[model samples]
Target chain A: MFATKLKTQLLLITILPLLLTIAVVSLFILFDVLDSIESEVIKRGDSITDQAAVMAEFPLYTGDVDALQEVADLLIKTHDLNYIRFVDVSGQLLLTENNGNDKGRLREFSSPVFSQAPDLDDFSAPAAVRAPLGSVDIGFTDNSAEAQRFSAYIKVLSIALVALALGLLLVYLFSRRLNEAISSLMTTAERLEQKDFTARVEENGSGELRNFQRTFNDVIASLEQNDAELQQKINAATASLNESVEQLSEKNQALAQQRQETIDLERSKAILEERERIMRDMHDGIGGQLVASLAMLEREQDSAVKENIHAMLTESLNDLRLIIHSLSMQNNVLASLLADFKYRTSRRLEPLDIELDWLVAPEADSLSIKPQTGLHLLRILQEAFTNILKHSGAGEIRFRAGQQQEDFLIEIEDNGEFHPDTEAMSRGLGIRNMKSRAEKLGGSLNIEKISSGGCRLILTFPATP
Target chain B: MTRLLAVFFLLLTVLSPVHAGSVHIVLSADSDSHLQAASDIKAELEQQDAPPPVTVRLLKPFQSFQPAADDLLVTVGEAATRYVSQSYSEHSQLYSYINHMALPEPQAKHWASVMLDQPLQTLLDSAVDIVEGRYHNKLVIAVSEENQSMRLQIDQLTIPDSVELEVLVIEAEAEPAKIIDQALFNAGALIALRDSRIWSGETAKWMLYQSYKYNVPVVGYSQSFLKAGALVSVYASLRDIAHTTAQQIIGWQNNQGRLTQEGILYPRLSIDYNKNIARALNIPLPESMTAGEQNNVRD
Candidate 1:
């Protein structure tokens, strides 16, 4: 299957009819001209016959063979005759003249010759009366007709071929221009298919093709404008959608933050209410026992047993005061609470033969402490000071408090004679009580023997606790 | 009163016969030949024993002229014949010098013709005289296809002495030379009838030439044949036409303008001979033939 392009097909459609019409018209013209020439030649042949017959009449009447021969020769020479003959009524040849050429077709005409002036008064009239003396037979050659036909054929064929070639050239030129225009339009259409709206074609050629090119360009322009407007609309819609999403995300985050804050506020309120209940329970139960024991012991003095009892009762009362102070401190500032504990501790240490070293950081002033956590830290501190007084036998005590990596560090040291391998010291109630208080506050208390013959106790916990 | 009325009616009847007895000749002549023939007919009519009071009306084309009732119309030539036959058919018309007569309706009885051409009998009789009783009874007459009616009339002739009439029919598209050659074969004498196709142009010369070749004589219808080597020619002269036409009128007049079977008659004719042709053929003339019978001779 051979493929035909639009241009070739259009050229074929235009050229075939033109060529066929030229061929048909040429054929018709050739045939008509040939027919007309043949008829005229035949008419010429008949005219020659008539002329020769008239000239031969007097010669035949008088039986003048020389005159008849002269007339025949003259006719053969004057016209394009192949042969001329004069035959009498008895089929006798009287005179004949021929050109000795018979290659082409022949046209023959025969006419009778008679005496026009027969003597009506003479009874002995000649025998050329009621019969033709002789008939002139003239033969004309058709070479001219043949030559004319050949010439006409050649002329017609030449004209037909020229016309056909000219028609094809015109068709080809027209089709080529048309195809170029169409190709441009097709290329534009392909570009438009690929979403490129800026494609255009030149408005070349004439008439409808030019109009089509202009129309296609206009359509592409309209499409480009529409595409730009559409892109703008899409960008606006995307921007609005992004803004809506961002606003929604921000609102969701704020709502979660507020919900978390509300939960923290509820938890803090519950913790404060629990701490007040614990303080009331402690004041009503253990606070009355401490005050009664002290009063009883003050009346029994002067004996060694009674003096020992009085000292123990005074220490128990101080210990109970310390617990109350740690539980009752309000403002929740660790540094201020530590300052009050230091005043009491320094007063107790003054009655002994030891000097207290206090080191508290200013960062502690902004640190907040829970009430239960404060009580646990105060118990651990008191146990350490009491042990220093009763068991350390050191001359001075050093206490330090500061923040260490998100935790509060407290250190207490004493200058005393110490032993590392004493099971009694590890199992002692005083040291165990300090360890229990440390565990309760989510902190660790460590005791180490100092190289300078004193013992060190360290406490560490988160500052917020 | 009845006897007196009868006598007055009888007188009127007798007076009407006297006026109606006068013969009226309505002459419609259109050509010089017809005018001459008309005068000849008039002169011949005046010589009658009882000539009628004649009325000569020379009519022109498309002109209407009514003839008196009971008058005889002398229509000369074809134009006169056409006018009187088409216009005044109720009157009795006697046509003369008409080369061809149109036949009237079989029921209509007023039309008759005196033919301008000699009758077939006259031509045949002249043909027999030229034969001089030689070659027994063979006579060949050639007629063209158009004049087959003349051949039919010739067939009705009462030929004498068991004469065999060989008719040579000339076809419309035949070669004249071939027909003439065929007509002259084995014939005592040839009669070339007056036919446009068989005796026109060079045909007359061809016929005479063929007759000379066959050593036969041809008796034709025109005196031109005598000069053209025919043995004899029999043709009706204008005087003969006038004399025959007058005779027909007299016959009709004697019978009170009533047309008769003799109304159609052949005109008298003159005979011409070519003496040189007869001598060349070596044919003998009849002893009773006189110089008076020889109207003209071309040596």
Candidate 2:
């Protein structure tokens, strides 16, 4: 943008004043020369006319036409006049001579011939007063003077044109140099914008342009040096940042390993706790019954006692099988654990002449629980069955398990005597054990005597623990 | 004897008229010369023992005049003489202040005139006096074709043995410079005659210019020429002509009212000199001519 603008500006600066001066000076010279030529022609015409008037006085006074004619002819031929006429004082033409050169512009000059008288007072001096005898009229052509003026005009014009051309050439050469210098600076500036600090301009031209070149080169050199220093600082900063990033990555990997180890240690500790809890339950429940059965066999050898001992051994094996089934279940499905409990309880109920009605909804069968939660739920159901078999003596029982809104519900209903001591039975060890196990499963258990001479036990828990 | 002689003379004187017929002086123009001649004539007639009653009258153009046949009519200038001679053909007339060339022909037996021009002998003598042995003793004169009578008069003059006279007759239409140039060639003096065709106005100026260019002194016929650059002038003065006219009128009265002179008369001549022109031309005047009362010398 700047280069194009400067080119036009430089051209105007150089050529405008030169053209104006040449035009004005040429016009002035031409006008002056033409005016001078015209004046000279008029002066020459006046001189010739004055001489003719003096020579004509004698002939005019004597009324000599031939003498007047001869004077007119000689003057016309010698001075290149178009025509000459001698007129008397009354304006009558006495004699006239012409050369037939009356083709172009003409200027006429006239002078009066005066009658001379001798001065009586001063013998050597002519008289001061005179009377006009006649006049001589001369017609001078402007052809020669016009030709000279035209030649002068051409010469001045030619000189002006040649001078203007030379001036234009010099202006073009100088402006071109200036444009080149400015263009170099512009190119270098554009490179500087693109972060190419190595770009520089050549120091050329004169005066202000030369100074501008040097200043621009100095600025570019400073920028290049600064850019190099900044690049070095940036490289140092990048190296330091990379080292910090590497250290951070290593620290993050170590933290991740430590976290995984801690997680495994927590899981192992939890599993060991669960195993100890299972061993304590078996020792407390099945081991105590087995020891009592053995003691009774040792004391009495009756047939009924032997049969009771065999039943006790079978019950302890069933409890062991239920615990193993709950522990082996996948994802701790509460329905599978519940089904295993029912199978064992139903067989026990068949021997006791009791009917068991089991109903499990599809959603209840697909319900998932934690392994510990499933084990707690299975223990809760077993406790309920044991109480029914030993105390309530119900002939039939119904069990139902399904989802209710955002919670799960399990119902166990038995047709049994409505004992007036139901509140006392809820305080029994089996019922307390079921309640404790239900609390551990994140659920609740309730046993109540129904109005229909049977009892219902309900367990409800949230769907997601 | 004294008583007898005195009675006889007294009887002769008693028969003579105490005054002649009245003298009438008529002027042609009211010019100074004509008026002066009339006054002189009246004065001269009054000086007589018994003078006539002179009545001076100016002649008007186209006016009638009938003079007494016996009266002596004294006409001044050429115009009054011509008019009186034509109108009163038989009247006794005496003409004064008239040139000889312009005088009227005498028709009456008693008419006479005192002419203005001097004789050729007198003009030549004045020219010789001005030349004074300079320029080879030669004299030059120019005359126009109209003045052939004057040219004949010049040819008839008795020129002196020591002098050579050259006469040039110019044509009426010819160039005067060529003729003047030829006349002033190595001449001692140039004699200028009073001819309107050859020597008047611009022609006269040219002649004077040529005369100066040739260094020849000019002898002119009038006082004006002397002032105009002539070395000497020979002409008749108006006072001399007036005095001459007074003499003729007295003579006519004395001769019984008839002019004593029968034909044209000549006045006494006067000469004038321009001392400056004489010094410039290196010519000397004769001592006698310079000392004369009529001689006039101007710077």
Candidate 3:
């Protein structure tokens, strides 16, 4: 990647010398100007010296050495001749200048300018030769005079350099700032991509950058708002799903109750079967013994003994059959199947002067067709009706049998003068027998007082007929 | 404030000898010392004798002798203009077209009308730095080392105003024969110089000064002026005349003594007793002047 950049650098280096050539040419021009000016000055000085030397030689050769020396002294003392001397044929100085400390120029002239006389071959000085002659050496130093000419040049260069440096520095700083901003933008964009819009770009100083920062912050704020709204929606959806789950759980509980009812029916049926076997055995064995005893008594021709034997056999048979029916030896039976059970119950109750109303709907026949269901139902009805004849005082008894959906509903309601909730009220064995029978048959029976005042029995069983 | 003004002027008097009250200063370069001395002497005549109203001109470093319009010449002809402007607001600083350097180019142009068209003295820095940043004059001190005898030694070297040798037959003036001989010799030298064409008429003028004038010196007659301490034929009588005839010395001395910067001022003397003619003449030392031994130019 850098090879091309390196090539560009090399190209720049190659071009730099050509650019510097312009500076060199400018310097050459300056040198030429100085040389020309100096030459002009020197030429003018030489001419003046020649003319002045001619005019001054008048006092030299009159043979008055004092005056000759005076002329020489005048020449030396004059402002121009800075260093001039009158050296005779024998090389004796007449006069010269004396600057005590600043001898730098005199020292150079002392080397060869004085001794390298123009007429080296002319060693002879004739008696009439002119004297007090001065030679001229000149140069120009007008730097202060020309100072204005250079001011603009120097100012231009100084200002240009300053401007360039300032411009370059500011540009470089600005570019660096821009690069940093771009880099930060990229980092923010990546974070934004990750949904971390909360991280904000901090802008520094004044400029468009601050605006960009504010805009970015606003964008993040909008995103946060959106995030909140989306979260609220999600929460609402979750609540709805939870409610659905609760409804399903409630339905499952109901289903479980039905299953349990079925299970109970099977268990109660097994218990009823065991009880029926026991009762049958008792009838066969115990009833035969009693009968035999009775027969024996008859053969002796003893009327008192025969009568006792016959009474014992009859009571034992009746108690054993009641035990068998109370065992609830039935399966999958409906409680409402005991439709004619009420007729039978009232018939038993009539000699006792007990009133019983046993009512069953036409639909109750469906429940009664199942003998297992009818058997348990008839037992409960018989017990309740017997209880009404034996215990309840001045009572009107009601037995209702119907089908409510798949359930057999049986209710035994009684209106009796005896207190319904009083512990002092006698509960006959027949009522207990009725309640036990209903429970063993996988059904429930409740005794409640009606608003009109009386006991009411509500019995419910699965209509599995 | 008044006293301060007095002190400022006093300092100015001390630093500058010729303070032309209303005239702007002009400095020009002159390579001819003799002519410059004559010119200076003439100018001082007016400066010293004139009253307070007289304005003096301050000629700058190494003034030229044969300037197209010498300061004194311009003064004599009244060719000088006074630049007494009421205000200097309009004048811009002077600028040279050559080497670039800043100058305190005050508005002397507007303040002072164009006085003369002569080249002014080189700018202050220009004049002072003309000698390759070195002293332009050689210090040739020739001291007479003997009490009765004129011994060969240089004590101090003084810059001369002008130097020449002029010869006249003061005693031989009545003798046409002697004058003719001298004139023929001088004239022959001129003709010979022209024939050779090597030395121009300028050289002929120098020859005339060397041969006849015993006062002014010949140009480049001898090269060993510094080494021999004093050149030959430089009369001892010259020293006495300088003492007696130096009427313009005060103004010149004052100018020389006044300085704006600190500098060591040594006595300016030029010849040594060792020169053959100086010893031959047996010149006496001034009562106030001290005699000394020769000093090395190297020193």
Candidate 4:
């Protein structure tokens, strides 16, 4: 029945138009149904109920007993209400339910509304509008106007259904064999969209529809097949962008750190270099003087003097040494770096016996890369090791660096916990600094959990080319 | 007394009829015009004072044998069985006139034949010629009486894009007789409503897209047709023409249970009928006749 030439094409044509039509129709019908139901149901309330209440109350207040009764009874009968009564000041039962205010509840405000209403006299004489008479309450039972709305809704639904069925049937027969072609094309197109580019629509239905489907399929297949190449390009572009962004972020952080360091220097505002020279002089040249002073205290047996000289002089020399090291020689090949790194790391991690393994690959020994690159690599490794020590509870870790194919590769693996929760990883300085260092050298890094258990940090850097 | 009067009149009628000469009026049995002629004569003669002794003879629509070296064109009644049976024996009778009847709308044919004392052929002839297409080598317009023949070709040459060749069946052979014209008109109307843009496009992709994404209704007579991409159709009716012809026989006879001198024309129901179609085609029939799917009408 749906035998279309280009099965997929005709199918798409039939389906899309039909679907668009149906969707539009359904939305239209739904809104239409809602509007009708709302208007009609509310209309039901506004028209009959509103009218009955307004009209019935009018005569009741006008002091015309007969007219009031007639109006009340009419409203009651027309709308099928239950009771209509009035009350007056008499405390007598004159006008009952059928009558007027002669027999009803007391007209006092304080009267118990829940109790049966008192009575009063029927309207008489000048018809004083029945005194601010008791209230008039009119109501309808539980059959709200929802029923009408529901029926209208049902009618709309059925009509839409039947119309849809008929429309489909017409296209089927009229198009006949063409539908088959359309269907086959559609199948092929679907497969193509799912990344099956090899799929081709059958060019077998009506010639034109078939050709249409086949051509479309061919185009889609090509587009799909080329997706891999496209992805490669996109990924390369993305990598470049990410590298730029990372460099920018690191520059910004460095600028901020420089500003903070300058601020700290201002606060500490001292010629620490001059102070270190003075301290060195004081230590080397005045050392004998301090020692002789301590000796005089001991010889005189002045414990107070001895303790004061010992504690004060001893603390001064240590501070002087710190100042000298910080201000003077920032570059010390063997002892300086090892001692600095050791002191810094040990000071940080000694409290927790976190293990640290440092391995230099063949390339580091060969020194093909600049010393700065080596230093940067060392910093990154240090940052990673610090992270492992601070966060990774793993009992063991391994760090290895190598060079292959004119590329430098570094691997850092930890055995304990692989990756910390992402929230924790995102918040810290450890990962950020490591990633920035890697990008600064035109290298990429992948941090992933190893299947064998734990996390691996793999960094590969391209050579100058 | 009433019984005796009836008996006496009946006896007198029998006795008087004993010597009356009989005129055997032979006609094409199922031919619409001849059927009309038969009914007209029957009504007229029935009103006459003692109708002349008469016997109306009826023959099949198609005849097989050659007419004794003197015959002219064969009527529809003579065209049938005659071709198959290969015999043409007992056909001579009173004067016969073969009327040049036009095709009528299906609705008109139905009401005229079933609910009214009118021939369907007259109705078919009255329908307007709308869109023209060749069907069975005859030009057919979307009409109410029947889906007359119309030819459609959707080869690669017709359109700019991939050509789609599809066959539209207004009335398939399944029903073969119950002619429901309104249904077919409905299908044709739907077809006419489609934008001309549907003719050309990459056929398969569009179709799959439409079916899955749009859930568009495919016009067809049955689920398969719909599955194959047909949206609607009339149920089995019009295709059963032979059965309908036989069924219409009851409507042809008079109160005396005798066939009318004029032949009767039966309405052909299509596989696609709808109520709006009757109005569109200007056929005066009750609206209840539209019980079918919505499918395209092809002659």
User: How does the DockQ of candidate 4 come out?
Assistant: 0.00
DockQ, all candidates in order: 0.08, 0.03, 0.01, 0.00
Pitting candidate 1 against candidate 2, the one with the higher TM-score is 1
Worst 10 residues of 1 chain B by lDDT: B99-108
Flag the better candidate by TM-score, 1 or 3: 1
> Which scores greater on DockQ, model 3 or model 4?
3
Scored by DockQ, the top model is 1
Question: TM-score, each model?
Answer: 0.42, 0.39, 0.32, 0.19
lDDT of 1 by residue, A1-465 (tens): 242766556666777688778878988988888888888887887788788877777568656799888887888788967898888877888878889988888878888875554443211122443546678898877888888888988988888888888877877777777878877887888899999998989776579889878888998999999999999999999999999999999999999998888888788677656765766766666666766776776776578887788777677767666666776646367887788889888887888868988999988989988666777777788778877887778889888999998788999888887666569867777778887888877788898988898899999887764
Runs of candidate 4 with Cα error greater than 4 angstroms are A1-13, A16-31, A34-38, A49-58, A64-66, A82-137, A142-146, A171-178, A182-465, B1-299
Off by over 4 Å in 2: A1-113, A116-131, A134-465, B1-20, B43-50, B61-63, B292-299
Superior candidate under DockQ, 2 versus 3: 2
**Candidate closest to the true structure, highest TM-score:** 1
Best by lDDT: 2
lDDT per residue for candidate 2 within A5-101, as digits (tens), equals: 7557767777889899889988888888888888898889889988898778778877889988888878877898899999999999998888988
Regions of model 1 farther than 4 Å from truth: A1-274, A277-281, A301-319, A329-331, A429-443, A463-465, B1-299
lDDT of 3 by residue, A83-129 (tens): 44433334555444432334223211221112112231111222332
Model 4 C-alpha RMSD vs. true structure (Å) is 46.3
Worst 10 residues of 3 chain A by lDDT: A107-116
Residue pairs that clash (backbone atoms under 3 angstroms), model 2: none
